[model samples]
Target: MAMTASTAGRRYSNATYRAMRRLKTVGLYAGVAAVLAYMLFPYYWAIVSSTKTGQALYQFTLLPALDFSNYWQLFNNPVFMGALVNSGVVALVSTAISLVIGILGAYALGRLHFPPGRMVLIAVLMISVFPQVVVLSGMFEVIGWLGLYNRPSGLIVSYLILTLPFTTWILTSFIRDLPKELEEAALVDGCSRLRILTHVLLPLMGPAIASTGLLSFILAWNEFLFALTFILTDENRTVPVAIGLLTGSSRYEYPFGQIMAASVTVTLPLLALVLVFQRKIVAGLTSGAVKG
Candidate 1:
């Protein structure tokens, strides 16, 4: 009888423990779902508002009305189209420049043995943290001196300040983590440093390059303060600045629907880029986290 009683007690304890564990798992999932909803709700609202027109924008409707007049109007706007082109040109050119420079700079910093190399890396990191607003006046003066003011070239040059440091730093970490044996083997086979970089390292750095380039593109694309301060012409403004300056038919009215539609439109490219390179970004980030 006592043995049977003990067996029943053990079974009851095991069942209680499993119940507790199940409850904890449920709570964890619930919390995660809540946090995801909180973070995503604003974007969802923007998408919904993009489909609304006029007074419908002011109303809090869970379901969108499927109206696309706002998108049609935005597409028809010359200013918006010009801004999109300017953004694409500036971002693509700046990302290309930064990646080329970053690859060479990171290679030297990672592979070469020299004095002040660490100091240079530290300086690059320090430069990245400086606020753009602090350097606005100086950058503006330089732009004017270079005769690039109000030009897309000026924005491309200014964006180097944003793209170069991070790209170089991230690439440096990736290069540092790479196996030195391959480079040494290339040297033994009479390959020069440039050849090694172009042949051996470049192919291996596909993920890192994609990650860095994507980040640089996004930075240049979404930049507003410099674009606003430097670009004097409507045709040269990027998407962010153009969206901010969007006007309604009447002076007293704000075109909320058009604004949301523009926002959604500009955001689509960024979202697609991120989604496509999500794995590469993750791999690049975590690759050098632990040293062998």
Candidate 2:
């Protein structure tokens, strides 16, 4: 009788342990789902609101009304179209320029031995942390002096202040973590430093480049203060500034639907880019996290 009772008690304890573990797993998944919903709800709402028009827009429903008149109106707006082009030009050009410069800087800082290397990197980091508002006056004076004010070139130059530091820092860290054997082998093969960087390191740095470039593009694309302050003409404005200037039929009315539509339009491309490069971004971010 005692032996049977002990066996039964042990079985009960095992069963309870399994149940508790399952419950814990379920709770963890539920918490993750809740967090996802919280983060994604705003994007979902923007998309739904973009599809709504007239009285349907004001209705508090989770589902879209299936209307697309807002998008039609958005595309028909010439100013928005022009702004879109300007934003693309600024973002792509700035990202490309920053990457080129950052790669060179990263190579020098990461690969070469220099006395003031750490100091230079620290200065770059300090520059990066500076608030846009603080540098606005200085950047404005420089832009005017360079004859780039009221031009896309001004926006691009201003964006370098934001993008270049980030790219340089990230690329520097990534390159520092790379094996020296690759560059040594290239050098053994009669490759010059520039050739080794271009041929050997460049190919291996794709993930880092993609990650930094995407971030730089996003920063430039969504920049507002510089775009607004620099570009005087409506035709030269970027998406963020142009969207802010969007007006409704009457002075008292707000074009909520059109604004949402524009928001969705600008956001979709970024979403697509993220999804496409999701693997690369993850790989780039996690490359040096663990070692054999």
Candidate 3:
């Protein structure tokens, strides 16, 4: 009788333990869900507000009314279109230039043993952290000297200051983690350093390049201060600056719906890029961090 009682008690205890574990798992998932909702709520609201119009925009509701007139109106705006084109051109050009320079610089930093290499890396990191406002006056002077003020090219040049440091740092860390043997073998096969970089490292570093390039593009695309300061003409302004200057038909009213529509329009491309290259981004970031 005692043996049977003990067996029953063990079964009850096992069931209780499982119930506790199940509750813990449920609680963990709930916590994660709550955090995700909190972070995503603002973006969701922006999307919802973009679809509302007139009196409907004033009402607070979770559901969208499916009115896309605001988007049509935004699309028809010449200033917004010009800004969008300028943003694309500046971002693409800046990213390309930065990537080329970053790849070569990172390779030299990672693979070549030279004096004060660590100091150079540290300096690059310091440059990344320097406030943009501190350099604004100096940059404006330089832009004027170069005759690039009020041009998309000027924004491209200014964006380099933002994109180059992080790109070089990330790429340096990534390249440092690559197998040295491959590079040595390329050298043994009578391949030049430039050849090795173009053929050997370039193919192998696609994920890291993709991650870095996307980040650089995003930074340039979202840059406002430099664009605002340098671009005197509406045609040369980027999306962020253009969005900031968005005004209603009347001076008294704020165009919240139009603003939200423009926000969503600019945000979607970034979202698509992130979603498409998410795995590569995660792999590149983790590999650089862990190995270095």
Candidate 4:
């Protein structure tokens, strides 16, 4: 009887412990689901809102059907088309400058040692933290002096404040991780520094360059303040600013569907980019995290 009682007690304890462990696992999954829902709800809301009709939208229905009427309307509008063009132009131009300037500057800083090289790297990183508003005063003055106000070039120049420092610093870290032996061997063969950089390091650092370019492009695409301040007309305004104007238009009472549709279009390119380079980006981010 005593032996049977002890065995029963042990079984009960083990069963209770397993039950508690299962409960804890379920709680953890519940917490994750809550957080994921919080973060994703806005995007889901936008997607649903884009499909809703004006009456159904105003009715505040919870579930809207997936329809392309709003998308069709957005594309039919000339203003929306113009905004897309302006955004493309600015993003392309700014990315081009950032890529060229960033690659060369980062390579020089990372590879060639000189006085205050570390200080320069720190300063470059700091530029990324400086608030965009702080530069407004200086940018406005420069624009005024150079007569670049309202020009596409002015927006491109302003975007450098957003792109360059991060680009330089990020690419510097990437370049530093490249094999030093490759460059040394090139030097042993009597190859010039510029040739080694152009012919050897450039080819190997392609993925890093692509990551930097993608980031710079995203920044340029989403920039609003500087574009809003400088670009007054339809021809020069980027998509974000133009979309803001679209929401204020008197045509059919600030169509939510149209605005959301345009937003989806604007965000699609970034979404595609993130999907394509997801692994590369994750690796780039964690590259030197555990350097020995």
Candidate 5:
């Protein structure tokens, strides 16, 4: 009887311990979820706020209304439309140019054991991080001297500083992580460097390309400082500067509805891209660290 009682007690203690451990795990996950919700609430609030009519906006409405008034105002406003076009042009051109250059450069660095390879990469990183303000004067002088001031090309040139280096470094890391045997076999078959790069290497770099291109698009799309500093004309101003500088132009403070509408409008393309490429993004981001 004594042994039976002890055995039963042991079983009960073990069950209690397991239950407490499970509760602890659940509590931990719940805490993490709460933190994530706190972080995301502002963005959620913005989505809700953007849909609210000007009167309802400040009235503490929690739910986003199913309406098109804000969308209509955003589109019908010429300044918003102009800013949208300028932002699109700048983002598309910069992303395309940076992709071309970054892909070629990344491939070369990945394949070649050239002298000063590490040094070159370090230099590129330094150039990418050098402040937009530091280059402001030189950029202004060059653009003005060449008569490209207030032109899209001038803004494009300025944006390269924002996009190119990060794109190259990221893609270089990705290319380095790809399998080496394919390149070796192609080289052994007497394929030239260009042919091998075009056929064997690039074909396998779909994830890297998608991630890098998407990132480039985001960077160029969101850049404000260089856009503001480089382009001064109404027709040429990128969305950020247009939205940001509006406060100075209006006496009663810029319209919150207009600003909110513009903010959401500019954010839609990027937001959509993020949603569409969500899976690709995760794979691209993790494959380098995991597979490498």
Candidate 6:
């Protein structure tokens, strides 16, 4: 009788432990699902709202009416279309320039040795810590002095202040992880530093470049203050500023539907880019963590 009771107690304890483990696992998954829903609900709401029009837009329904009139209207507006084009031009130009400069700077800082190299790297990182508004006055003055004010060139230049530091920092970390043997081999083959970077490092740096360039592009594309301040003309405005200036039939009335549609339109391409390059981004970010 005593032996049977002991055996029953042991079985009950084992079953209780399993039950607790299963309960904990269930709680963890439920928490993750809730967090994801919380984060994603706003985007889902915006997508649904973008498809709504007229009186239906005011109705807080989960189901979208699937009306695309707002999108059609936005595209038809010359100012909005012009803003889109301007945003693309500025973002692409800034990203390209930043990448080129950043690659050269990263190579020098990461691979080459100099007395002030580390100081320069720290300074570059510090530049990004300042708020855009903090440097707004100085940047505006510089833009005006350079005769680039109200030009796409001005926006591109201003964006360098944002993009360059980020690209340099990320690329430096990535470059440091690359093997030194490859560069030495190239040097043995009579390859110049530029040649080595262009031929050997460039191919290996694809993931880092993609990550940095895409982020730079996203930064420029979404920039508002500089775009608004520098570009006086409606035709030269970028998407964010232009979208802000969007009005309904009356000045007091806000065009929620059109605004939501514009937001969705601008956001989709970025989402696609992030999704496609997510692996590269993760790889680039985590590259230098391990020595071997």
Q: What TM-score would you give candidate 2 relative to the actual structure?
A: 0.97
Cα lDDT of candidate 6 equals 0.93
For candidate 3, lDDT tens digit of each residue in 216-281? 999999998999999887877899999999998899888999999999999988999999999988
TM-score of every model versus the real structure: 0.97, 0.97, 0.95, 0.90, 0.90, 0.96
Q: Candidates' lDDT values, in order?
A: 0.94, 0.94, 0.92, 0.87, 0.83, 0.93
Better of 3 and 5 by lDDT: 3
lDDT (Cα, tens digit) per residue for candidate 5, span 1-292: 9999999999999999999999999999999999999998877777777677656877786677866676787687687689889889888998999989998899888779899898989988999899888988988898788787888888888788878999999989988888889889988999998898889888877777788888988888888887887777888888888888654235965566656767877888998988998887888888767541
Clashes of each: 0, 0, 0, 0, 0, 0
| CA lDDT, candidate 6, residue 194 | 99
Residue pairs in collision within model 2:
none
Rank candidates, TM-score, best first. Answer: 2, 1, 6, 3, 5, 4
Model 4 has a clash total of 0
lDDT of 1 by residue, 1-292 (tens): 9999999999999999999999999999999999999999999999999999867877998888899999999999999999999999999999999999999999999999899999999999998999999989999999999999999999999999999998999999999999999999999999999999999999989889988999899999999999999998898899999999999999998988899999999999999999999998888767877776
In model 1, residue pairs whose N, Cα or C atoms come closer than 3 Å (at least 3 residues apart or on different chains), thus clashing, are: none
Q: TM-score of predicted model 6?
A: 0.96
**Model 2 lDDT tens row, 200-239:** 9999999999899999999999999999999999889999
